[model samples]
Target chain A: MDILTISLVISAIHLGVPIILPMLGGLVSERSGVMNIGLEGMMLGGALAAVAVTFITGNPWLGLLGAIVSGLLSGLILAILTVTLRGNQVVASTAINLIGAGITAALVPIIWGVDGTSPSVPKIPSMTIPGLSDLPVVGPLFSSLTAMDYGTFVLAIVVWWVLFRTDAGLRIRAVGESAESADAAGIAVVRTRFIAVMTSGAFAALGGAYLSIVTLDVFQASMTQGRGYLALAALVFGKWRVWPALAACIVFGLADAFALRSQIVGIGIPHELLLALPYVLALVALATFVGRTSAPAGVGKPFVRA
Target chain B: MTSTQSPPRRSRLDNELRAQLAVPSRLSAGGRGGTGFGTFLASLGGTSRSVTAKIVSFAVTIAVALIAALPIVYLSGSNAQVALQALIGGSWGSPQAVAETFVQTIPLLITGLAVALAFHGGIFNIGVEGQLIIGALAAGIVGATQHLPGSLLLLASLASGMIAGALWALIPALLKAYRGVHEVVTTIMMNYIAINISTFAVTTGGPFAAKTQPSATEKVPLDAQLPVITPGTRLHAGLFIAIAVIVILMWVLYRTPAGFRLRLMGANPQAAAATGISLPRTMITAMLGSGAIAGLAGAVQVLGVYGRYFDGFSPGYGYSAIAVALLGALSPVGIAAAALFFGTLDAGAVQLQAVAGISREMVSVVSGLVVAFVAAQPAIFRLLHHLQRTVLAGRTARRAAAPVLPPPINGDNDLISAGLDNKEVL
Candidate 1:
């Protein structure tokens, strides 16, 4: 394959990892009946935490751990507000998003004494599988990805197994579908929801850590931009399932990759138009497909015991 | 003091906290009279007792917000005292500062009402950001390129903005009402599309490029510009116009039959439908009204402040408006107050950066906290009421030997009960 196509495929996979991780996180949260629009906020906080920790410790892995911890805390906060307090889920989630953005922006200036961007930190090393290196075109594709990118692929399968093949998964699905029924069946609704939300936060944080420590190696204000929202849309478009959600994320990642590649390749299409492709497509997808798809039976409702 | 802090009193305080926590769940289950500033404002515009409730609720909200931000200030390595001083001095210390505060309040007031209005009608129209952008562009293009008399051009520009905003919102409204699509998702999509289209329009040598600044559209003709109300500040005629719009909107929402139907639809869609009110029609009307108001906010920004449509002119005014609406408790009077509060924070942002050595984005922290606290208001109010009851119980027991009349639960509840379903408020 030519350099353009080779680079395009690699970039698409790299870009897809961040979105895919979050989308999976959202799937887990939503599947357990909590609608976590706060994924954006979790990712933002995680991004900052990853950079700040990496900057301090000089270890990318430790930074990733810090990101996960922050993300999990964010999830805990959301779960408390929504599940326990029974606050409006949408409002609480929006608050999380705002808090994420605000705290990150505030800390950047305080820690780095800078605005907009953070100091560069160590990036996670890329790795290639030994046997996969022997192939021609496919070898480079498998070899070029960062470890986190490969981890994300493994995460999808792991999440699928945990979600479908385990007793915990059954309880989560049961609670998500009908909390009353789940409660009747001896499941702990609040505990299930809390776990799902926190786990979701962890996954999203991993995505965020990838952005800073694996993808770009630095944190910037509003760096995730609307990618968190994009993941939510992908979750919905994929009918809240794991595998289809992966496909949807890849498509979005491809759109992004294509947009950037087109700009570089000097394609005749307007850069603005290319830049707009992902959003416009997402809008179209939402208008047509979102209405047709069925969400969790108790997606946005706060579960209260009788 | 040690005596007052006895075990019984401590247990009572714990009881009060639990009771407060129970209020929101109770409110949610009761299906009416939910806790929100919207309900508070609805009561504020009512009888004397309700007005008092409104006042108390508003005060408590402010107190809660300040307390919430205290930790952040402490974490920032500054005492609360200095941050408070900075907040006050930066927002209202001087005439210039006050004028800037008012100027910042204009768009916020307009958009806050916009969000509040849709919210009052049971719609979560998150696309106000998109509406503002499109509306601003429409007004900017019309005002800059047109060669009509000054007054006519101004009116035309504002109208174009309203029309454009309404039109843009119409798509989501129709889809939401007819197709069962959630407005939050669709509107978010629309915001992205709007931003993209606006970005495309403002590119160098693009169709709407300005003569001097290619990244911006031409400035509105001087004749069409809003006259500055203050000498050395950005305060402009749009402030009065925005206030006027707020008043008119309040009047329409409170006094009109259409408004009654809209509220009915919001509060109980099933009942509204049973009463022959068309859900789709009411939703569309509410969405259109919201869009028009949001558009006017954008238009005023262009005509009164920027005089041109620069790329990314708004720094999330639409989003901030959500906090403003809730902070104000969703009454016209409340919205006015909320706008001023946020305007002060926004105006003070730069000063906070300079005086307290904090980031200007601290306003967002405050806004976020306000949103979170507002979400928790029912519980907060319940807690406050419980504490007051406890204190009053203790005082009456020791001092007068007189039976204390039950503290009137906020009269705000009755107003909400009469008009809205609390569940629909979110």
Candidate 2:
């Protein structure tokens, strides 16, 4: 029981960080009606950039910031496509994903000064709350620290609040539901969409930062792997509402935890099958809600002034 | 907001854009003409388009794409001159590089053609990757274990790959048809499933795994492997087969009745069904044919290129094929050219690394830029329409007799979106 509990908690923390950061990213662009398929690439690019930057600067915080900036740049390109040019969101997103894969594979050598692997670096510092420190299993939450772990919880609630309670949120949703209506109502649809996409980049970058700083302390090609896809699935499974989306991400986190525990406990299951579980479950959940759930309606489509 | 308030001439450019870009969905069905082969021909060559017009339009598009590529290349390097030299040399510089370019393009062209076919038939076979991986594994295993004569073994590998690809697609096809589960999501999920399964069998438990590359399956027997088309280059016989397949596709698409049915279904399945076309049989066949073509792409990759199955040998060739098929405008001839073009880029990537000192990531950026350009074609078309209309208005005012402008494209209409142009090879 102790083994299962500890394994579950670790897996949740591991999978949760990747999912939550990307979820924040997805929430941004998706909320604004741009389908950010390039989240995978952004996460990946950020992951590699973080490791490389950390290795060079020997500063974990700088490395984390570098990852965020890289993601922002990727999101910026996406903004250029979906916002300025009003191109197909899905197409632009796919291109970005490909860019991430090819870019990371190529940069791995140049940044690391090695063919495949990079030098290991120091980790991000973790902190615990003063009074909450002596608590049981939850007290050690601050032990294996990365900067984004604390930020994720804060951002989730803040973003949810900013999305639902603020005037900016109203305008963003208006742009998503009907750009024409939004434009007539004096909302800057293009500007809002662009900001939303840029914010998405920052969030996805944080996900990458979590990996380089908190998760592994290094990077590899496509290392962000299909976690980006799972986050997207979380967005869909959540029906695009922020809190529900986070909840969906937690489920994926648990599934990831399940796989990790199976591995640690010698479950005798194949690694391939274990890795395949989250995706399979994602598909099942997605399929169950396939036609039932609707996206922002304008998602994957480019909006133009009439 | 201020732009809309400008003078008519300036705002008229906006008007021209707004005018040209109407919702095609708004076109009432009353005056709609039949979209059959007769319409296809009329739309292709019998309308307002002249050879000069076609040539000019295509040239302008290519020029714009290249011009857009300039900034990207410059940003990719500080030493632009060296980058250019390396880019050209590394990609087209050596015989081996050129061979590699063409070699890589073969499976893409074939798989792209398959995708084009199904998309044209209005079935989205997005599971091409899953199908491709399975096909490659099946044939690789067959080629490695079979003791048959060399020639027969080659034939068997190809068959097994095709069958495997076809079989992989069967479930999604059924789900889409009966369960009403959209093939897009189902196929994407299946791709993940298929990839994992293939990885598992080849690495740990698959019956035909090798001892040397214990992480992957065994290589095919030497005799069963594809012969080289070019004696000194990496280019293999797969190129010839891909070309032959393209020719076969063109003939079937334009000449055969079954081809007629596929096209008919593609244009409008409901209408085709109303006219007595068999929806189920036609749908199933189109899907199977698409699977087979994608399967062929896998067979060639394993037998002609890799000679063994490993994880991710494709490097997204199946997905790239989708872009190729669309860029080719879903024609067999077009797909071949697009495939070759993409092949050159993949080839140039190595050159970028070797000569320009630019990483492979920049090549991906270039590719994304190209696709971005392709997706932005409609917008570009609108821009061109504005330019042409303005120019024509000037010319006609001076002459007192200008020809009427061509109609603008409606973005809302689902007219041959190359994104959905999932044209693997239909």
Candidate 1 lDDT by residue in tens digits, A1-306? 875677788888888888898899999998898888888889989999999999999999999999999999999988988788766677778788888888788878878888889989999988878998768767777677887887899999999999899999999998988888999999999999999999999998888888888989899987886778788888878888898889888888888899888877878887777776777777677677666557777677667677
lDDT of 2 by residue, B121-228 (tens): 656566888888888888888888888999899999999999998987876776655544445545666777778888777775655668878757787887889998
Which candidate has the top score in DockQ? 1
* Complex DockQ per candidate: 0.47, 0.37
Task: Please give each candidate's TM-score.
Answer: 0.89, 0.82
Per-model lDDT: 0.78, 0.70
The CAPRI category of model 1 is acceptable
User: lDDT tens string, model 2, A1-306?
Assistant: 354475477568778878888987898788887878678888888888788788888998888888878987999889987778666565567667766776677666655556555678877766766767666665555454445677788899888888889999988888877677899999999999989998898888778778766878778767776788778878877878888788778788887788767766777887777777877887777656655446675665566676
Q: Give me the displacement of residue A163 in model 2, in angstroms.
A: 3.2
Q: Global CA lDDT of candidate 2, please?
A: 0.70
